[model samples]
Target: MHFVTGGAFHGKAKWVMKTYSASRNMEGWFNLYEAECPETDQFETSLVVLEGMEQLVKKVVQENKKGTREVLQKKLQSWLEWESDVRGRRLVLIGTDIGKGIVPMEEENRRWRDVSGWFFQDTAMAAERVNIVWYGLEQTIK
Candidate 1:
């Protein structure tokens, strides 16, 4: 699978969409972390481990209260299963602002940075190929 990543405004999303559109593979996953989305932003890398753990706890509780835990888990499981079951080439696009320097802020911003970083790490481990986008340029990180 092809995994693409980059910081904000780096054109990772555009590249991923373009690449996916040009490809013939029908099985692919697009995971995007846009700054506009609070959840995505919360998953950044700037937060400490303890902060991340706390945020995860809060998220679990929030999702559970909304009765969305099962649904989200099921979807994640299905994606993992698909990743394993597919025989032909597969593509997975994961976009984030990884290399962007830490944001100078407290609490919320820090939490977002931490979470985003964790998500990127997990995605990279699961992907076979990893590409980093910077200034609209692409670099292979894995």
Candidate 2:
């Protein structure tokens, strides 16, 4: 798995497409918001791109009935496990860096930021290679 992340509009998507030699095909690219993550199945091909994971984390944090960090953590744990267990799936995950910049004034926003930071760390640790794009430049972390 390759984890790519950076600030919004920082060229993460462009870097990912170029790095993976991906074309503009619906079969290879996926928007996580359009699909139900909990019910998503294993990929059959060599590469699969799952974009907008930051939004998914926020959505799960907002939608979880318990509205607790533990619930969000558990859900993310299951989702990441599912991704790791898939056979022959080379996943390119694109997420935004939400923990930086100003601290949120709202409690929920702060919680989301905190949870997203933790989730990203866990995902990065699982990834075989991780990269952060800054001003369209790529820097490898692993």
Q: Which is the leading candidate under lDDT? A: 2
Clashes per candidate (backbone, < 3 Å): 15, 0
**lDDT per residue (tens digit) for residues 7-88 in model 2:** 8889998998898888646476777657654333545555778788777788877876455556645655555665667666
Candidates in order, TM-scores: namely: 0.56, 0.81
Local distance difference test, each candidate: 0.48, 0.77
Model 2 misplaced regions, further than 4 Å: 33-38, 42-44, 65-87
Work out how many backbone clashes candidate 2 has: 0
Candidate 1: which stretches are off by over 4 Å? 22-77
Residue 137 lDDT (model 1): 91
- Estimate the overall C-alpha local distance difference test score of candidate 2: 0.77
Best by TM-score: 2
